[model samples]
Target: ENEVVASMSANVFKVQVAVGDKVIAGQSLIVLEAMKMEIPIESPRDAEVAEILTQKGATVSTGDVLVRLK
Candidate 1:
């Protein structure tokens, strides 16, 4: 199976994609906030969202997995 995993170099602010949602390449999946600036995480492939590993306003690191696709 193919998957789209997302992570950031800062705190994650929100997850925009849900499970079972169809996503395209370069589509936004999560938003990360760092130093008061918002960063958006995008999908790498055209697939369906399989899991959400981060919550809204959750503190995350560079290696954190924000979303998974299948």
Candidate 2:
């Protein structure tokens, strides 16, 4: 299993995938807003999304787990 984590402190702007969704490397899994800019958090490898740890509008700090995949 692999996890997608927040790279910086930010508010989750959007969630593009859900649990059980099939995903590929580089696909956007979540969007975060930091410093007034939108950042896309992407999948690291091909996998099925196993969990979403954050929701839209949630605040997250660096290294916080956002999504889990398997």
Candidate 3:
């Protein structure tokens, strides 16, 4: 299992995937907006989403725990 941390290139705006969803490597799990740009947070490997630690429109900072994968 691995913890998916949200590293914002800008600012966190929304979370897409939820716990129990099977995700492929490089899949977008969260969406972030900052500086008029949208940034996507992606899965690093094939795994099930174990936990969703943030909600839509929630602000998250760099290195914040966003999801857990198992």
Number of clashing pairs per prediction, in order: 0, 0, 0
**True-vs-predicted CA distance for residue 51, candidate 2, Å:** 0.4
Best by TM-score: 2
Give, for candidate 2, the lowest lDDT window spanning 10 residues: 1-10
| Candidate 1 lowest-lDDT run of ten | 1-10
Question: Candidate order by TM-score, highest to lowest?
Answer: 2, 3, 1
Give Cα-based local distance difference scores for all models. 0.79, 0.96, 0.83
Ranking by lDDT: 2, 3, 1
lDDT string, candidate 1, 1-70, tens digits:
3543444567778878889999998899998888899888888889999888888867877766778788
lDDT per residue for candidate 3 within 17-52, as digits (tens), equals 878999999999988888888888899999999889
Of the two candidates 1 and 2, the one with more favorable lDDT, higher being better, is 2
Q: What clash count does candidate 3 reach?
A: 0
Alpha carbon deviation, residue 69, candidate 1 (Å): 0.6
Tell me the TM-score of each prediction against the true structure: 0.85, 0.97, 0.86
